[model samples]
Target: MMNKLYIGNLSPAVTAEDLRQLFGDRKLPLAGQVLLKSGYAFVDYPDQNWAIRAIETLSGKVELHGKIMEVDYSVSKKLRSRRIQIRNIPPHLQWEVLDGLLAQYGTVENVEQVNTDTETAVVNVTYATREEAKIAIEKLSGHQFENYSFKISYIPDEEFVGAIIGKEGLTIKNITKQTQSRVDIHRKENSGAAEKPVTIHATPEGTSEACRMILEIMQKEADETKLAEEIPLKILAHNGLVGRLIGKEGRNLKKIEHETGTKITISSLQDLSIYNPERTITVKGTVEACASAEIEIMKKLREAFENDMLAVNQQANLIPGLNLSALGIFSTGLSVLPPPAGPRGAPPAPPYHPFATHSGYFSSLYPPHQFSPFPHHHSYPEQEIVNLFIPTQAVGAIIGKKGAHIKQLARFAGASIKIAPAEGPDVSERMVIITGPPEAQFKAQGRIFGKLKEENFFNPKEEVKLEAHIRVPSSTAGRVIGKGGKTVNELQNLTSAEVIVPRDQTPDENEEVIVRIIGHFFASQTAQRKIREIVQQVKQQEQKYPQGVASQRSK
Candidate 1:
């Protein structure tokens, strides 16, 4: 026994000064020294009496950081030196060979070869004195016997032993084969230590390799235990399009699962209510596998979205007098219709020009269509606009110190973004307006969403939900809502957002009705873009048939 007490379960914030103050408050005599660690500490006293008193008084009685401290007398480490356990001895090594090896260092009073399993054994060589055992350990700890290197260490905790052995001893067998080392975990016969000594028998290289393998396995087990307590990744997707993501008879989702080794399950249709048309998609796997699955899932969803957009565009094209140019549909320089034939024998409609004046005035509200649907490459940046409502508390994180973060974000996203002032003193949220092409919108809005998440605006276990508002002509609201709400339902399916055009709402000065979109950042942005397209279509229809519009207005 030593005149020192071990103090465990200490808070990291506890300092030497705090310890001294605590001792003073308790009226305990000063200790000789204090050795502090992350979550444990050691204190030396002037004599054994003080140490004993400290243990009696403080053990399980003192509290720090919500944990009761564990105090006990320090055990003398020197006592363990006499009992030397030689590990990682090649299984083929006869008992005579091991005996001869230990004989060189000291008189081996007792040599017990405890067979832990068929392929591994531990030899406990107890010398007559501690000096002999120490000498043997120092000289032969790293010595190579055949192809196995010796690994010598004190016993580990019982938990580590259970982890090493695994269920039905399968883990140890795998580790033995992988590291080419025989691992022997001794059973504890006394209460001196919570765990028995584990020894490895192998070549010097194999001994080190075995140690690494064991540590890695232990770490993996710990990580898995922690993850078991965490929530699975829940992705909200539109109820209608989730079928597309699942593929024809769940083939798409099955393929993603096979490739990524992750299990995915979507919420049942019964879970859907008027408030939440989106279904929750739960992904379960290790972090890396979950991330891979997310990528695959999103890829399938994007493809579905592109196809849906193409279908919608085709439908819009059939509406007589719909100006694709005014709607910025041909900004990608793709010809939706052949150019008009020149007067008389002139060359039939000169080759299409990208900068043709007929393309109409480009608006920042909607980005130019520089890329075709599923284009292989984007040569020029196209502009897009998105409006976000962020909690006021999280705005500082997005802005950073003196606007450094915001400036960097603008440059990185290649977009012009601004945060509007608070509407009033009571408002808890502010509007973040972002203008950029698709890539820019992705970067800028993604950063804003990420910033809010990092700042803990939403619980770590929950997905971040955001609201975005866009304005469209009141007349276009009918088309957006569609006949019997079919169009809005399709938009929600395509974007995975809750689209609400409040009924009988008064229009703004511009005769525009506000469409409220709510969902995760990506879903809300997608819904906004789709609604803008509908607004553009309505504008073109009004321009094409003024007489028909007037007649409808009169009616």
Candidate 2:
């Protein structure tokens, strides 16, 4: 049950004070002021019994300024249940006393204990029927049981269960972990029915946070599941925050597009609703690209939210028609909406293969990766390989005792990691061949660099720089080198990484040869991405015009 009632069919002559006088005459007190709209209004009735009475007595019964009034719950249908919660039961209260007290009003179908971190007890008491529960609430509420108060609150307990349990039960688990709340998805009760009632058990403080997270997850899944040619992600931000996201003359938006390889567009001003006041930001790209853009966009939004919070706090209404409670801000006397959190509660990453299945450039044999909601930290999930060289003496630290550290790194990165046999005794460097997707390569390489710095492999305050080698098709070597070595030089300048291609190198059995990259982790990663892009261009060129490629090769 909700306290906010929608009051409609009001005459233009009726003022908020007129409606207030009517409720006041009926001994009803409002939790908040009436939000007056055109010929209608919305007001929060603090108590459910009072709200029920207001609906019964006023809706289509009373005349306000010669117009019949309409009053009803603002919450959506079927969200309510035949359950009422009783909190603040003294710890010493016996079950017999509670049962007898509950029996006085209605038939007790079931009662579930709600876990809390306090001495006071709480329970979800489900009556035999909705009518019975209604009676129980009306009669037992504000009544003392065993000389103790049992504060009653109706629980609107269920929602769309699918969104809460995301890809492989990951989202609900995250809510459990992050909010310290346990979510029980009761799927068996109504196997074929769409509406599944889920239970969330948590302390009072964490309950709101968990509810907010579940709502967000549902909102996101609802937006992205539309049947479009390309799946486009739409983010709704307050109109006041959109300007900062786009930046001065759209620099921020442009930067995000270039960095993430996505196209972003904002909804037209004409679509702005006085009630919503939100602008829809449309981002189109691969899921990975959109994921990256989402992070950046949310960062900008959070910054604006923090700065605008002060101004919103000082004012009574931040957005004239917006509801602060709906935005998860319930601060007393202040109506401030916090920043939107990015898509969260993705599944834990897939486990790593200790041994490489597609070893040494054999990715064709491996199955395509399944798309899942996963964490992205400035890296993609496309399959890749990197041959990272570390100091020979430092290899012990990299391997750790009995190869434990390397195994841990592989697990964390979801990659198949291997250390190559040293070329000869006393060699200056040893090779660590990392086989995995792009994100794994990023993590494994990043950690290796960090470990080197931590172990004093580099001077204190010195950047941990290393050489990384990757193999590319011999035919694309010239394309990477370019005419007069222009492409490689540009890559070097752009990424601040050294790119070297030794001339007249014999192609290996796979018709591929080595391209060495030397720089810090970020620089090397950028250089590799650029070089691989050139390789892709050459491959596409060959596919389109084979004879032309042959002629160019002859030149």
Candidate 3:
């Protein structure tokens, strides 16, 4: 059987297309075209689940031009085994209407409408129990006395409705899942009334806890709403109610919903009632949830309410709003609002504290005192000092390839200058020292440092150990060594650097002379260069002859 439902009291503006589009958007395939009657329409869904969800969600809600909507199962087409006769049916209604209404509960075997001969066409209708006709009878009871009336000869437990449905239709599904017991919920706007009962049927065991759980879930879902809380909890109360519960900008209703995990709506009248009349704040949620929100909101509101009430009463007793106002009220009776916090939670810095004047001494972190007058003594000033180290090679550069650079730099900076000798065997290594005020020393150092660094006078050198061998005829040896080494003494004077020659016949080589240059890195390099020049000259001048005496110099 199709799960056809009836929708009624739609706005005149509502069209069949609007209804079709709503279901289409939900992805519900329409089993049949919507039958749009004057103020109502019938929709058939593929199954019972969609029908139940639709009823649970949209029942009693207004849509389409502010018209309240009503939904219910369609009448059955088959006959029933048992049913009470319901007559005086609306003339506008037809036998098809009865068939659609009773069919939702069980198999509807028959529906017959008996009409009077009167031109008004008042009539009687009968349905079989096989259709679970009792459900149709109950739902129609209140409605029949008015537009539609019912005479129920049998009664079904109201709670049994939910039991028959199952959890979100699970109970119904279990019986119908395999065998096809499609249960549909056609809810009308009058569901809250005792006379307007929900219908149910399918497998005999169809009515179970499944419906109860599902109905509970639906009701809970419909009731819950939420919002974020801001502002101090203390100021939330108004007229003795917690003000925060009202919410910043009147969102307290939202807070109650969120806190209780249930939906709550506050009527505009109820909001005014909080302060003017009843002074009660209504909250909705799960039983426990609502209670929690209620306590908190009420406590806050009460505190604020009481304080305000006290203030008003006191003002009336002490200071009249009209009549001659006392100057005392304007002056001493006012209370000031507290000031906001300072930057970064810090107190303002204290004003500058000037130390008491004293000629003897002064000491402080700020505005340090001038030096005290006392007997003159030698001591370095309390200021920064920059020590400079110059390489020996750079010393000559600072001296300016001569001594002129040092003299000029010293005069420019008002600094005393001392330059040490160039590093060499005959000359002691030199150093230029500058001492003066920081400013003067800094200027002098800058000039000297910049010149030396830019010129890059320091050159890298390699240390090479050398062994020179000389061969001399045995005959010429005695002559070269002249009485008591007079000739060697002259050679020693000729070269400032050390010179050593092996003296005895036991020596391995025929003859050899070794010289070593020891000085600063650059000085040693220069000395080596000079020694090489001298050696080259001697080699050119002195010529060897086999078993011969010294040769004369050749041009």
Candidate 4:
């Protein structure tokens, strides 16, 4: 398999394709698709030779987007594996502890405490693969167990033994399973149920683990079998007085004990495990007191648990922001919601006319204004109607779904805004007309501009290129362009700038009026700005300026 190299210091804007293009251009024979992670990428080269060359040639030499790249030969996978083995050893360990810890990383054939002829504990050792054993010996030579401690050695067994029989029969079975070793165990035990020595026959690395597993299983079963029972019961009663219910101390308690012939334990209130919170007392011994004690403990627990839960809930309620009543964001400053009105008592709401001039999202919050009884009444002279058309997409957002927008608008503009309805052919048209005192309309427009300013819809000082193109049919061009395009009657009447149509030999034949907008960044950029200003004005006019109402500008 090809080796993988981890590449780092990538710019956030860089993509996987970009990396591949860079390497491909440099003639690097990458073997597979580049893998990209959140902050880095990895590339695999077909051969170690290519990998080494790339490392030497490109290390600290490649540049990306003006930044120098960092590179090095990636560590071989085998070396990485060895590093993991040495670093994860558990602390304050023994043979068994180390075996369990290392087992998680990979198979640990056997972890044995080596002993000399005199049976003195020498060193605890382990192994992964047979080959790894040799690697271990060379790497761990003269190594100390701790800081400046005993020197230990990891000597590789010569042609590591393919078999290692354990202390008993169970040992070989567990080892066989753990290490996937197909080994046989020769039994040497008598009539006694205890397992005998077990022989594990497998590869060197496999034999040790098979033996380890067998030993662990047998040890567990033995522990379960050897057991003990606790003493039955012991009951101590109050001294003397056997007569209160037998009431008095021992008289009462002892009478019951005697009658039942079972010992009983009775103690004074101070001696009992019950205080004021647990005022009830009971004799605990024999079946009778045991049952009674259970009843008393249950009663006390219920009371304690209930009281604790209530206290916790109350503490949580006292925190400020957590309580709904403390916030004034949307709701009026009313604590309890008023009960729903009865059928006859509740008044009907004003009609909701979507296309009506002034209705907006927050309209319901304001008091209703009385419309003139006469259907056709005019309040202003000249009665000029200026139709401001906002994009249909912006209508809902500006109106805020409900009448909130229009209400806020009317309140600020000091005029009335009427939204034209959605009729069959004009469905896409969103027309808002302002009608009121002329001064109010002007004030409302300014207020709308201010609202758009707050919403970041306008950039008054931004400069942009502007261009306009007008075209006419070839036959009409003579009349439209005039001689030398000087007396261009059509262009002069329609727009401030000269209009041009390329006089190529073969012109586009479809010939219809074409108005092309080019280089006019300034004007086109102001489209949204101008629309937003108009929407804001409509909103202010729809708002009610009456007392006690708060005005909201879309933030």
Q: How much is the lDDT of residue 276 in candidate 3?
A: 18
lDDT of 4 by residue, 475-514 (tens): 4433334466543433333222333444453446665343
Model 2: residue 338 alpha-carbon error in angstroms: 30
Query: Which residue runs of candidate 2 sit more than 4 Å off their true CA positions?
Result: 1-382, 552-555
Ranking, lDDT, top scorer first: 2, 1, 3, 4
lDDT, model 1: 0.57
Model 1: per-residue Cα lDDT over 364-443, one tens digit each? 11222322343223232446556789888888888889999899989977789899988898888889988876556656
Which candidate model has the greater lDDT, 1 or 3? 1
Candidate 3 lowest-lDDT run of ten: 330-339
Question: Against the true structure, whose lDDT is highest?
Answer: 2
Q: Using TM-score as the measure, name the better of candidate 1 and candidate 3.
A: 1
> What tens-digit string does per-residue lDDT give for candidate 2 at 437-534?
76567567767876776576875334568999999998888878877888788778767789998878999999998999998765776677677767
* TM-score of model number 4: 0.19
lDDT of 3 at 50: 58
Per-candidate Cα lDDT values, in order, are 0.57, 0.61, 0.38, 0.35
Global Cα RMSD, each model:
24.4, 22.3, 44.1, 35.2
Give the per-residue lDDT digits (tens) of candidate 3, residues 32-148.
Answer: 557676677766553344554454345465366688777644332211114333433556666566557666666654344433342223222333333455566567654553444
Evaluate residue 151 in candidate 4 and report its C-alpha lDDT on the 0 to 100 scale: 28
